[model samples]
Target: MPFTLVLPDGIQYVGLAFVSTIWLQIGQAVLVMSARKTAGIAYPRLYAEKAEEEASFLARKFNCTQRAHQNTLEQLPAIYTATVLSALKYPVFAASALGLWVIGRILYTSGYMTGEPQKRNTRGGFIGSLCTFALTCTGTYSIISLALAAA
Candidate 1:
């Protein structure tokens, strides 16, 4: 409720954008837990284990979980930027794109948990990537058009 006062424009969509970020963070936490549990190496043991040798079934699953999270981390900034820009310029499209990205990420995570990153590409990871790309392109166009109009 208070957030509306601070962010007057597209409050609902902005809130959804914030929720998307929270979702990503939750995904990261879930992945960390999955990795720890799958690897059968908790705390110090997990930290002390060598990263290079991940031949064990559990280790592989843990790696997949970690990689999925890492991939998300890599794309998070772009997601945030695109969401913000699109929200400001085109609220409806922003919401749709952000929603797709969020949903796709959930599907991607589910596929990743199967211990096959390749499977993720076929499932939702590719779709998520496409959605994120669309967001970025839209945001770029919005910024450029707005800047040109201002000039």
Candidate 2:
């Protein structure tokens, strides 16, 4: 016997959106690397050794850029999982949410790169959080629906 898996329609959109998010993450990492070089920060040292007051503006900016990317990495696993799981039942909605999440992350990175930590909580951040919450709820609903249908 052979095992065959059936995928829902519109799943391609979800896949494309997911790939876009990955590309966005890579772009953020590249920006961090560029900032690190511009700030003269070297590898193995996560941040500047100098005090905040003593650090050059470029150094401070580098730290913020790095942190922005780090925050995205921290959230990626959950976002990816929810995106895929939710697509099982609502592929279009999942894709749209993922797209919004990517846009929000871009805005969040832009604000954070300004070297003002507080600026990181921009409308983009709120949009991203909302999308994540929506995806989580949809994913949970999808799972329950599947289970109930099987029973």
- Model 1 bad stretches (over 4 Å): 1-9, 42-55
lDDT (10s digit) by residue, model 2, range 115-148: 8877888738898999999999999999899999
Roughly what TM-score does model 1 have, to 2 decimal places? 0.81
Clashes of each: 0, 0
lDDT of each: 0.74, 0.90
Off by over 4 Å in 2: 50-53
Task: For candidate 1, write residues 1-151 as lDDT tens digits.
Answer: 3555344356587677668768777867777686777677666543324553355767767767776777777888888888778776777778878788877877787788677778777668877888788888888998899799999
With a 3 Å backbone cut-off (N, CA, C), the pairs that clash in candidate 1 are none
Q: Give per-model TM-scores.
A: 0.81, 0.94
lDDT of 2: 0.90
The root-mean-square deviation over C-alpha atoms between each candidate and the true structure, in angstroms, is: 4.3, 1.3
lDDT of 1 at 31: 76
